[model samples]
Every structure is written in structure tokens, then in C-alpha cells.
Target: MASPSVPTSPPGPSPSPSANPEGFCALSPDDPAYRVFIDSLDYLTPEEVERVKAAVRFSDKAHEHQTRLSGEAYITHPLSVAGAIVEWHMDADAICAALLHDVLEDTGVTKAELVEHFGQGVADLVDGLSKLDKIEFASHQEAQAENFRKMLLAMARDLRVVLIKLADRHHNLQTMAAVRPDKRRRIARETLEIYAPIANRLGLNKMFRELQDTSFRLIHPMRAQVLAKAMQAARGNRKELLSRILESIRAKMDEVGILAQVFGREKSLYSIYSKMEEKQLSFSQVLDIYGFRVVVKDIPTCYLALGALHALYKPVPGKFKDYIAIPKANGYQSLHTTLIGPYGTPVEVQIRTEAMHHVAQEGVAAHWLYKDAEHSGADLQIRTHKWLQSLLEMQGADSSEFFENVKIDLFPDEVYVFTPKGKILALPQGATPVDMAYAIHTDVGNCCIAARINHELVPLRTELKNGDVVEIVTAAHANPNPAWLAYVKTGRARSKIRHFLRTVQNEESAALGERLLNQELHNLGVQPAEIPAAAWERLVKASGNRSIKDVFTDIGLGKRLAAVAARRLLAEDAIPIAATPGSLTIRGTEGMAIQLAKCCQPIPGDPIIGSIKKGQGLVVHTHDCPVIRKSRSHEPHKWIDVEWEPSPGALFEVRIDVEVKNARGVLAQVATAISDSGSNIEHVSMEGDPERLFTRLHFTIQVGGRSHLAQVMRNLRLIPHVVRIHRTRLEMEP
Candidate 1:
């Protein structure tokens, strides 16, 4: 059963509707809509109200020409927004802020005006809720994430900010029907996916339910209608079954002397539909459908109530959980049990104290809901602090992965496992041992090689079960493989691993570029100081770089090719190299004439290519040509066509020189090793004449590409007869 946060009061929020007598035609400030608008001022003082009103009036005047698709005045949106905050029982400041929410956004009314009128508190809320107003995101996903991050910062400061924003969203969701269909669906989807979840977390259950149902109706109307009808039909047949189940549980609790309030709980249609969609379950197969929660007096009674329920019903052995003993980081506590009820049917039961029930439903909002919650205990406060801080910490994290992790972590279906020390940790249904490793520590993730679940060796990808004892196995030298990233599900693991790899890549890139720079500088016969640091800065900017490190890193990563930066730097110093490497070649004109080089027979997939020549080697093509045409006159030497023959058809001639121990069968073993890789030595020479005992062997062999040659060299190096092996790619020194 889902433990949504609930407000602690005796349901004060289904407030009676106050009356408004005057009609719109009278245009009086005393009208019902205007009165409700005025009533929203509970969060503000009278002076602030007047100031905010003046700002709203100014905004109304500015937006006078703008109208909504519903044909209502644009001012109606702000009024509706104000009404939403009022309904949230929020303080007057939020109501006034909501009224001006659009003023700074849709009209020229500025944040300055809002601050001048409503004070900085309300003004800050408006500014936080407003669009970035500049710097458009690259895509919808990026925009959604950026906007969510902004709201989270606001929420971290003041809960009422999100509360009011949710109310504003509620009103808009209600009015979304007036918008165009495509736009309506998009708006409804965002509201359903994000705002409703926020409302649920805050314990604004009414808004949460309504927003979800409304958005679902618009986004998937056919599925919505189908689900509604199905639920109705299911309720009709199961109404008696539900009542009997509730009675049995309540009677059992009473008999056990556990006084509690028991009520039948019905899952939301959207939730049921989502569960079905996710798990591919039929509505009837969705076993948690018939849950009924027992709200008790205290934590001890919660356990007693659970025992009583289990006595009355057959407990589903592994499905029981006791989060109350070790509450979640979000400060939720409850005893959960799934049982085989009458007729061997499955049903879930949740038991929690009044405080836990409230927190369960209201989440972070419960810190404000209960009278003494802030002072209740240090543990609750610490947990709440951790919860808020976690959100802030997670905001700097890669959001796409963070949201996914949160969904799985907060998902209604959870499996609670115990650490070796009896500490409890809740993981999603399919989380693996590696997920647990990463949860332990980022270094644990870096060194995780395998896991021992309950002291039995298991694969890193083994899915975890409730109550399983898991221990991670690590090697001192182990490191994260890119492949591990594919199977890792949790955001913490994914983000940590990605961060590790990115850091490694950056270090490697810097190191690699440093090496290349030294080599290139040496080739130029110029001291490193020949070009001043200022010149490097200018070269970076002329090449559109934010940092020299960025430029060098890009060059190392092949993102910014070496030739571009080399030419830029060389040209700035008035060096002799061409302005660009590929400017021209001697042999070709602006023509389609190109031919392959027979020397290397470099094929497409051979990691093969050609280089530009200033005078003679124009349009240097690889043995297998593909580039069909080129700007021949454009420093025609720059052009090259490349290809690779499949499997590198012929054995490559390379010589390996090794210093050997001169042991028995040394020459025979080396020859056998070379031939083992499908290559034969055509010639061999020995150094260190027979008496000295130390010897050298040079074997000429055939092989494929550099990889095969490396393998052959490795095999020969392992032989006892070989002390060292050296091979080099032949190149002519300038």
C-alpha cells in the first residue's frame, strides 16, 4: 500500500464555499470572485494587499489587449491563480503573489513592482516561479529539468512557494480544456508527471488526485474512459467483498486490543493503470488493489495491529515490512503486510501511528501540519533535514538519472532488506547487488568486482530479494568498466560512475595533449616559451575556445583535430607551415581525378588514410578509394581517399628483435610461438656468438594489423628464451 503524506488536522480543508453576491456586471470590489480574491490575502497585511493590488491593476492594464483562448480576459488567469492559493489555506502573501504571478511574466510588470508592492518575500516567490526569461534550453527535457531545479531551490527555502505554485497549476489544469488540443496534451502531461507528484508529496491529496484525473482524461481520454468504466464495474461487483475485508481486519485489531481507525482504500485509476502498464498486469491481477490501512495510536500498537492482522489472515511470508523501526530518509514509518485473505485472495494492510499516518500522507508538509512536529524529536528533524538536503544535493546531480532513481526509490512497490548489522534499507523490486554497492560508497562502486549474497557467491547483476543479506566483494585494483554502466540502474551508481569516467577522460586528455604539445614543439625547433602565454590565449579565442585546457582536451579527444589548432598557433607565430594543412597539393586541380596508393594498399576499415603534400602528393588516396570528388584547387594536397580491405588479407612483414636467456629449445619455441598466430618466420639471425651465452634473435614474420602484431609480440615475450622484445614502426626522420 502506498504511504502518501496526509494533513494532520481533522480534515479541515473541505471548507464550505463562502458566498459572493455581486455579479460581474456590477463591477464592484465586493463581488464573490473579488471577495475570494480578497480572502486570499490572509498571508499578507493590509498595506501589502493594497500595494499588491496596485501592481495587479498595473499588470491588468498592461495585459488589457491580451486574451486567452477561452475568450475570458487575460486578467482572469491571475484571479484564478489567487483563488487557488486561497483554497490551499495559504497565508495572504502567497495569494497576493499568485495574483501577480503572471504580471511580471505575461506583461511588462516587473519584479521591482512586485517587490515595491508585496515586499521581497512575495516578490521572491514570484521571481522564482517565473520562467528563466532568457537562455532557452536545448530541448524540452532540458527545459523541464532546469525548471524543476529552479522550483526545488524555491521549495527548499519556503514550502508555501511550491504549495502556491501547485494551486496555480491546479487552476490551469482545470482550465486546460480551453487550449488547443496539442498544446493541451503537452501541458496536461507535464502537470500530471511533475506537479501532481509534488502535490502528493506535500499532502495536498485533493489537488493531487484532481490534477492526475484531469490530465489523464485529456492526455489519454480513451484509456481514461475505459479505466473509469472498468473501475466502476469492478467496484460494483467487489463492493461487498471490500466491506467484509475491512470488517474482518477491524474486528481482528479490536480483539487484539489495538484500538485503531480502519478504512477501505481504493487505488487511483491512474495509479492502477500505470501499474498495469508498467508490469503488464491485468486489472484483476493487480494484487494490491484491495488494501485497507489501520491508523493506530503509537508505534507499539502498530506492531500489535500487524500481528493481529497476520493471525487473522495467512501472512504472505516475504511480503511483510517494518519501516517503522527504521524509517525512510523522508521520515516515513509504517508496518506493511500483504496477506492471503478470505478465499486465499491477496490483500495488503498498512499500520502506522497518527503521526506516521500524517507524515505518510503529507510528507515534508507534515513538519508544518502536526502541532509539535518541529519539536517532536531530534530524529524526525534530522531526517527531515536530510530529506531537504538530499533534494538540493541531487539537484546538482544528473537530473535525468536522479528522477529515475527517485521514482524507483519512492515507488509503491518496495522490498526492505537488512544489512549485516540489522540496519534496514529499502530497494526497488529489481535492484541488484551492484546497486547496493554504490549505495554503500562511491569508492565501493569503483572497486566492486562481485557480491556475496547471504554468503553465497552471486553475479553482480543478481536481483535482490527482501531480507537478503548482501556483502560486496572488491579487488584492490578493480575499476569501473564501461560495461557495468549498462546494467547499473540507480542514479547514484550511474552518476558516480559517469563522473568517475569523465574525470579520468579529462585527466587522460590533458596528459595526452601535454605529450603531443611537447613533441610538436620539439618538431618546430622552438622553445616552449617562443610563443608567450598571452599568444596561446589569443589563439584559443580566435579558434573560439573558452579555455586553453578545453582547447587542448578537445585536441587530444579528436573533437578539435590537431591540424586546426597547430596551424592556428603556427600562423600566429609567423611559422613556416601553411596557414592550414590541407590548402593545396601539386598534382590535382579542381577535378575528379584521384588514384589509390599501391604501396600500403590501405583499405577503408584498416584505420587508413592519407596526408596532404604541398607540391607532389596532391589528392593522396588510400589503396581503396572512396572520396569521389574534391576542391582540387583548394590546396589540393589536402584531399585523401581511404578504405580498408576486410580482415587485412595479407600477412604484414615486421621484424622483432629479442634478447634471450639462451635456454634449451629457445629458438624452436620462439618459432613455434610466431607460427601459432598463423604467421611464419622467413628469416632469423642471432647475435652474441655461441660462447657468451646471452643471445639475440631477429625473426621476420607476417601478421594482420597492429593488434595482431601486439599479440604475437606478447606471446614471444612470455617464452623463457626471450628476455626482451622490441619492435618499431619504420618512419623517415625529417
Candidate 2:
């Protein structure tokens, strides 16, 4: 499923191109080497062909000095991709864009110039394919993730964008031998996992096949060549077997009143090797030989043809899929079955109407020509839009998550289920109901509570399967829990949940901001009306914001520092900075008596001590005041004179502690005596003994002076459970 399998066989007689292209697909429009593109222009309008011709002319001129590895003009590569676009029936701009896809990267053509010449659509398309090298990342993984994210976003805007990109990659991969070996391996590995699968999803079967084959050749050149030789040696008999099978099916269908086209499909080397490596199968065990598609006239005839096919051969059990009823996510609808033939050999058969055949092969590309087809019947437009919407959803997702989801969704294996209304929904295998919910509607994903799979309630995590009728039960007030993100598999689900979570987080944080602002206001002891409008202006100006809302948002989001905001607001003359004990000292309440304590110094950590001077109402200092440091420095107005009190008769509170045991009820017993003495424990500090036998406790308590403190100490000494207790806040020997 990870391989570049054939999504659709080439319709008419045009030979399907190899997935990993051949050497530099000789794309020069002037040259006859790549006229296959013009010959394959079976679906292009006259105007579209002219646009392609114009693209070729511009590309040839721009790449005048450029040459490819095979000594061909560089324009060949763009022309090569443009040719593929013609086959896909992409719009004229897409064709032109494909031809000029590499212009901004390979040539010096600016996006502006391209827009001026070819229009914005073509320029944007070319720009989308252009690699991003402007930013530096710490790792290649990060860079790759970002690049892929950019590509998907652009492609989501326009599917033709990625189409051009895929075409560009296809040509480069085909000619990767011209690159260094290590580079070749990187490109091949990336193509195998990403580009090739995307090709399959788009139903560009020819491109997908060639991409896988080319990757196998470059990535596993030895194995690829070996497989090539093996297929070569064994091809004669395989072709004979295929011919006999085709003849049998054709004759049988003719007899059954069903006209069908049957052709043999040889599996690509990448696919065969993948089967060998992934499943540990032998080459013979790998069924790469059988391929026959039956194109009928209508849907009922398609089912009829399946029966006719089964009538002719015994279908290998567990290998049948009815995609016609529940088409693939890419709008592919065919009845695929592996059948046992003569000699017990296995062959894969695809049965569909001619319309489904067009969709199966063209994928989204079919949308371009589907309505215009002479025998068109199926609703290709609707299916294409559905897949297109998924791509759009993927594009809108978190790029980091999208990268992971793409690895799963783009691969070929998929599961199709049915709604109770009989509508079919296709999803990747292992996708849960959450993925389905997201696929249905973003609202459904948010409100989904439970799901009934086939009329029985099942866990949301249940893995769905083909034709399982699912009904989702929803609640009006339901919301997406962030935890649901852990189990999500699709990009849409992940993105939807993340978006919800982000929205909720923002709302919660905004509420937190209001609370924080109110608390800070309370701490400042300032009534809302007390702060003058002029003062608010100065503060807001210092904060560098024109409005308070901006300030609140900044603080809420952690964008602005609290201390900086406080400092800016306090810069006004009316509001002065006040120091707490062991914290910065500043003036508060003019003429207030505040002294610096000699014990704790009130540097930055202490609870503040404030004493009213004779005329001053309040003076602030360190509670366990220290000897003076510098009184003033750069900001003279912010500083206030403070004196250090040595040993006051009043018991000066100080912080002290000792490491002690963490026995049960130890803290309770220590507090019992302090409660008994009726002295409040102002500040207590505790630390755990890592050795598991002790605890450290520090306390700053209100003591009446030395004599009163002595009485308190004597009381503390009476407690037998008490460990060592100190009375001083400063233990520094200096």
C-alpha cells in the first residue's frame, strides 16, 4: 500500500510512464523527443494547449543556459512535467505552471515577473513548488517538517499546486542518478514515503507507479535491477499466463452479455520489493503478475461483471473489495478481487464501469474531463470535491501533525463505511470514529459523545471496516477534551481538537489575567477610583501600550514581565515603591518613619518592618534589619533614609532553623508549645532530610524583647519533642 501502485491503467494507447521516471524525460517542446505529451493531449481544449505552448516557450527561453545531467537542455524537465499535466487534464494555468514550476528556483525568474507574464495563478503555482531555504533550523527533521507543511498549505489552497510539485519530484527522482549517492538515497526515501503515496491518492496511477519504481531503482538499485532481471527472465511465461487469463475473462464476459476491456498489470519493482520486505515473502509468494480491469456500461453491470468474473475463477477469499458501492477516499470505485486461476496462480482483477474507470485513473484529474466525456455517467465532480475538501482540511491543520497524518492517509490502504442514511464514507484503515466525526463536520467532532457501529454502541476508538453502518450520538453541550487528541489519526481530527483546546486555554488564561490584576490591585492598597487618569496614562505609556486590554493580554500570555510592569506603574510620583522585609527598600507615605533592621537587612526576602517617625506616619525597613548597604544609587527619588536597629529591647523576630526528624505529629508537637505560649509563628521555613530521618524548620516569630524572648525560649525548651531551634535570622559568619 505504501508503494506507487497503478491507480488507473493508461486509457487509450499512451504508454504509462514509469513512477521513478526515465532519464530526464527529454521535455524540450521544440524538439521531437517529447512529442508524446502533445500526442497525449487527448483532453486539453485548444486554449489550454496554447497556454502549454506558451509555457514551453517561456521555459525554454528562461533555461537557455541550463542543461540537464544527460546533456539535454534544462527546459526538458519542465516540459516533461507539463506533458504529464496534459495527460491529467489539468487546467491551462496548471499546465503553464508545471512548465515553469522550477523557474523561481532553477532560474532567476522572480515571482513578480512570473505573475506579470503568466498571471498570479501560474506564479503562485510555481512558487508553491519552489523550495524554502530562507530559514535555518536546528535539524533536518525540523526543516523537512516545515517544508512539507508549507507545501501542504499551498496545495490545500489549490490542488494543482501539489500536482505541479509531484510532477517536479517525479522528474527529479527519475533523474536522481545524476545527483550524489547520499542525496539520491535521501530523495528516494522521501519519495517512497511521501510523494509516491500522494500520487496514489491523487489517482495518478501512471505517476504513482513510475515514482515507486524510480525510488526502488535509486533507493534499492541493486534489488531493483535484480527484480528487473527476474521479471525479464520470467516475463515471457507471465505474459502468456496473463494473456490466457485475459482471453478467458474476455470470452466469459462476452458470453455473459458484458463488454469489458481486460489488460495485464505488471507490479512495479518497488511494490514487489516492498511486499518481500514488509511481509517477508518470497518473490514467488508475491503476486505481481495478475492484472485485468473490466470496464462495463453501468453500475449494475459492474456488480454483474464481478459475478461473471467469480463464475470463471474461484476468488481468493479475503481478497475481495467492493469499492464501487463505497468508493475509495480518492473517488476510486472498482470491484477488486484476487482470483485463483489455472495452476493455482493468483491474479488481481478490477471491475468497474467506464466512468468509474476514468475516476479510478484520473482521480481528481478526472474532474477536469469527467463531465465532458462522451459516456460519462458517475458523479465524479461530487467525489472529487469531497477528496478536495479533505485535502483542504489537511492543509489547514497543524503542519507538524499534518506531516504524520499524511504518512498514513496518502498510502493506498483505506476502509469504507456507511452512514445510517446509506451514504458511504471512506477513511484510512485504523481510523476511529473521531476521525469520522471530523470528516463529517467540525461541529460533529466537537459534540460527538458515542457512536453506534452497525446499530450496536461501540467505543469511539473502535476500528471501522467496510460497510459498517455508523451513527454518531451527540450532546448539545459536548466539547472536545484535549485527551482525545492522543488517539486522533487524521489531521482534521488533531487540528480540530487542538483548535478547541487552544480556544479554551485562551479563555481560561484571560480569566486568570482578570483575577491576577484584581489581586495585584488589592496588594497595592489602591482603590480603582483613587488612581487618577493622568497617573494611569503615565503608567500605560511606560508599559508601551495604548490600551489596558493590550497590557492584560500581554501579562496573561506571559509576554510581559510582572516586575517590569510594576516598575513602570510605580514610576509615577504618587505611587512609590515600598520594600518588604529582606526585599528592596523604597519610600512610601511621605514623612513615614521606617528603619532598616540590622538582623535581616530587609535585602529582598524579609517581611518588612515599618516604624512611624515623629512627623512621618510610616517608615519601612527590613523586619530583621541589616547594617546599611548603599542608601541611594541611580534613582534618588525611589530611595528613603532607613536606620538599622541593633538589639531593641522588644524581641526582634528573626528566621532560624535546624534539620530534624520527620516523625509523625512532630510539627504538631512543636506548634503545641507555641500555641500554649500564645505567641504567633510569623514565618516558618522547613526542609526535608534527604536521608529520610530528619526535617529542617526555620521560624520568625514576634518576640517581646530579649527578656520576653527568653521566656518564649524557656517555654519552647519544655517541649521534649522539639529538636534544635535558633533565635537569630542571620547565620552568616562574615
Candidate 3:
């Protein structure tokens, strides 16, 4: 039989191998396509090529019964994927892994078998690229998310996993015409949303552009057709102009004695479409559709070329960026500037050394492609490793949450900031000092209280700007505020803050939960220590908790009633004893587990009760507060007697309504009185018509206790234009 037709090559720079040799129809070791694949492995040793061929033979046998939607032998798919990997000049193991990637998921081949044949390194690589298809999931989205998480975590361990995976996806996208339209759209969306961004993040520009264009075409075929036609027309119209600019730049470089290769660059259709969709611009409104790239011999020559070009054309102010000085997070380095071309048409130019060009084009792949070149890909490798290491830091989040965080990190419009020591840190745009602090270290982030931007004190939430020298001020007593979640931009910072807060909340909840449970047990005439270990284990099992701590945490968070849990922990036929008199005590130091009810604003001196709110721990409210009284009758079982410690550890917030004349200075006078009484106004607002003679100024102030709140009110009574002052309670009885 004639050899199966070679699969079509994806949209990339690599050339497709010649057609299969005659009389080599079936998948075999002597297949000409396999020969071409092995020939392309010139970077590998002779022994390595033999190893890769062995893997190809093994994969061929394993997939002999499988066929793709295009009716081609399934081995052809792995061969195509391997060809893409070869184009990247990846090592022998990567090519071997690519060849055997689908074996675990598709065939009966085992990881151990692969290990025996190719050793542990190749086995691990293949395992990383394989999906979790054997496991059941709740939904398609969950399965997809989990697979993505698995692949990413694997990629974290070995960056080659992603390179191989991207290649596999690229080949799949190229052959996707055989897929159903709905599935095609889904794959296209996934490619555009996740894979393309990942390729861009990793600095695989060529692959990134190709993935984007193909996905865009599949997702919006009509739009792509229209845009392609429009772009073609625009290209034809601008050809002469682009030629003139290129010639002028070449002449200028020669005149300045700067040896440079200047070539005109056309923007990809997907890029043009994205620009229009993002900025709501028409085709003609997008000015930088055509640009030029100047590749020079050295870094100094790159700057010299830039000067020559600027002299040749009028440079546009504020459109120049020196990424060469501060490379991008992905280790891309180039100088970009926009200029006024002939007839006032805009022209964008990029200047970079030959080495930088390789990096700009290949990104992390440059590390392998140019491994033997004079310019070692060490910088690119380090940058890529740093980013991959961060993926490891993002563990502990659930699958969906992990996927979301990674997506957030993938699309970075970077802003470069400097530490006090002058080390540069690249963060996503809109990143705050908190992100910078986290970028420095997790300890610094946890203890950071404020920042000094350019040596001037600023809020921690201040958005970092390019070239700003930031100094984070940390306090040992400081802890991450939950509010940081609203402003943090980096996934690392967001995840770190969330993880710390969760830990603190869990610990506080467990402590409070134990106290609540013990109180209930005492009410039932039992002591916690008297309960045996077996009873504890049974309680944990019955409560659907992993451990006794989890059971207490559930009770503390109000997910399970402490009274019911206490009863379940004891024997079924135990004798009743006399009830206890003490109630659960509140020290006001329970962190997030014990919260003061906003409506009642209970303080230490108030006769307070606790309401066990689901997922919100215990909410303290004054006994006579109308808000609590309304809900008291409906969920009486949730309400528990709570007494405040003689000395509560923290200040309590309470609201006071001050009726005053509608004068500008009257409000300031009341605030001054509260301040003089050693009370802080957390918030202040006005009610009623401000134009009227009388208005109400509401103040939410933090005070020590009931006596302190009374003192502040007494001070407010002494102020001028203060008509009446009373503590504000939500819907209280007169």
C-alpha cells in the first residue's frame, strides 16, 4: 500500500517535508517523512536521532488502529507535532515526547513501558503532555479547566511541556477543518483565549501571530474575510509609501555609516482587527498598519540606526519606547518609535540588534534555537523560568480559580518600576505598590503597610508608573487587608493575599468554633476534654469533615450548628446533668471570625447577643437593637448569649446622628468635637436637604466603649449649631 499522505503543515516558518517516498504507504521506520524528521534533527547527536526514531516506531504501532476525523492514520498527527517541535530545534527528549504525547491518552501504552524504552526523562515529559481523560468530571468546562491546570503545573516543572503542547495545539488547529463547526468554534475560542496568550507570554511571536490569525478566521470567518480583503486593498495602496520609507531609512543608515538591515513589516490581520475592535476604529483609522524593522549588528548600532531614522523622518513625541534598556518580562528587547512619514502618514519603526531580533521572534524558544550562537539564550531562559516558577507559587487554588488567575497573568500590558535598590521589576499595567511588594517577596507583601513612590509617601493602592522608584514600608504587626484584593493586578499578589487571608480566617474560625462548641457542650452538661478520641473521630466522620479541626471550623463558620455538633459528639443514651450558666465571651480580638453587626454597632458596654451567620461567623449585636429583634423570633436557635470582656482589645465603631444648622462650618465643628474626645471619624455623611436651615450629619466613629461614645456625644453637645445629638440605631424604638 502507498504511504499515507503527509499531514498539512501549520502556519509557521518551518518548511513542510517532501511527499512520502514511493512504496512506503504504511507507517514504518523507513517512511520518507520519518527520514525528513530525523534529517531535521541535525542539532541532536546520532544516538539521539536513533532514539527519536525508536519512539516514532513505538507510537506508530500503538496508534495503528486509530484514525483522525480527516481519515488519515493517527500516527501522522504525532509525526506532524514532532515536525513542529523539530522546527524549534528542541532537544531529542522533547521531540520524542511529542511523538509519544498522545500514546498515554489514546493507546494502551503505559508510562512504565515508556520509561523502560526511553528512560524517566522522556516518560515524565510525555506524562506532562497527556490529559486526565481517564478521570470523570462534573462538566466539560471543569474537565477542560482541570486538564489546563494539570498541563500548566507540569509546564511549571519542565517548560518544554508547554512548548510541546503548543506545537500539538498548533498542528491540531491546522487540521481542524475536519471537525464539526461547533467544535471548531470551541477550539478556536480556546486557542484565542488561552493558547495564543500563552504563546505571546512565552515570546513565541511567530507562533503567537499564527495561532491568533487562524483562530480569528475560524471564530469570525466572515469578519476575517472582510478584514483580509480590506487589508489587502490597504496593503496595495501603501506599497509605494512603504517602499519610499524603507529606501529613505536605508539611505539614512548608510549616510550615518550605520550598517543595518531595514525591512518593511506588515501588521497581521488579527492584530489589525483587534486594534479596530478595541479602539472602535475603522480600517483607515488604524494608522500603523505598515512598519519597518531595523536589525543591526550590535546594541550600539541599534541606537545609531534609531538616530539615523529619526533624522530621516520627523519623530512623534511620546510615541518612543526604549525597551532595550529595560527588557520586557519575557526578555524581549527593542526600541520602538512612531514617526511622520511622507504625506503625514504615520510610520512605526523598531530597532534592535540581531540577537534581540532572535529573541523578539522566538522568545523562550530562542534559548534552544540559538543555543550554540554567540549570544547565549541565558537571559531568555532565566526570564522564562522565573515566570514558570510563579505558576508553582499559585497552587492551593481550585482548578477554575487557578485557570482564571493564570489567564489574568497571561495578558500583561507591562509597567516597569524600580525598587529602592535600583533593581527593576516588571508588573502588569494598573499594578499597585502591593503588587510590587509581592514581586519583591511574600514576606514583604504580608507586612507592607505603605509605600514611598519617588521618595514621597503614597497609599499602598497607588498605581505604579514607569520609572518610579518604589519603597515598601512594612510593619511587623501589619497583615494583608482584604481590601487589597480590589486593587492588586498581578496574579501572584492576588493569590498570595487570598491564601494568607484564608489561612488567618480558618485559624480564627477554628478557635472561635471550638469556643462556641464548648459553650454548647457545657450547656448540655458535658466538657470537651471528657470526650474520648474515638468519639471525636466519629463526630468528624459524621460531620463530613476531614478532621476534628475542620468540624470545629464548620461550626465556627455557622455551616454546622454547634449545638447539634455537641450533641452528636456524645453517646446516644447518656444521662442528663445540670445546665451551666456561663455564656460565650467576646474579647473583640477574634479577627475575621467575630464581626460586629453593622446595623446595631454593638460595643463592649452594650448588652449584646451573637447571631451565628452562615459563612460569616458570629455577628455581635446589642440585645435591644431593633435589627436583631426583628430576626430574633424567626431564627431564635441561631442567637446565643454573648458577653463582652471587661476590657475589649479593639476599638468599636458606632454611628451618631448630629442634627445641626445647615452651615458649612457647623459640620467641621461637630467633627472637631469628636476628634477632641479622642474618637476617630471613620466616615461622615449628610442627610436631608442641604439647602434647608436644619440638616443631619451622620458620623461613623470608632470609640473605646459605651462610656467613650457618651463622652464624644457630650463633647458634641458643647459645639455651636449642634441642635441635637443622639446615637444612631437602625429602626430603634423611640
Best by TM-score: 3
Give per-residue CA lDDT, model 3, range 1-734, as digits (tens). Answer: 00012111121111112211232234865778877887888877777777776777777777877899999889899999999988878777778889999999998989888777777778888999988988999999899889999999888878888989999999999998899999999999999999999999988899999999999999999999999999899889988888888898888988998888889888999999999999999998999988899988888888888888888889999999999998888778899999999999999999998888888888877766774432536777777778888988897888887888888898658998899899998899899999999999999999999999999999888998989999999999999999999999888998999899889988889999999989877877777899899999999998888899998888888899987787788855454634554678888767899988777888889998988888889988888888767689987888888998888757888888899887778877887888999989999988876568799888889999999988998888887788988887877522
Model 2 misplacement above 4 A: 1-30, 34-54, 69-71, 89-91, 135-139, 236-241, 369-378, 390-398, 405-408, 517-559, 569-734
State, as a TM-score between 0 and 1, how close model 2 is to the true structure.
Answer: 0.69
The sequence of per-residue lDDT tens digits that candidate 1 reaches over residues 181-224 is 99889989888767886666444555677788888888998999
- Which 10-residue span in candidate 3 carries the lowest summed lDDT? 1-10
TM-score of each: 0.70, 0.69, 0.88
- Cα lDDT, all candidates: 0.64, 0.66, 0.84
How many steric clashes between backbone atoms does each model show?
27, 39, 2
- lDDT (0-100) at residue 397 of candidate 3? 89
Candidates, ranked, TM-score: 3, 1, 2
Residue 121 displacement in candidate 1 (angstroms): 3.3
The candidate 2 region of ten consecutive residues with least summed lDDT is 1-10
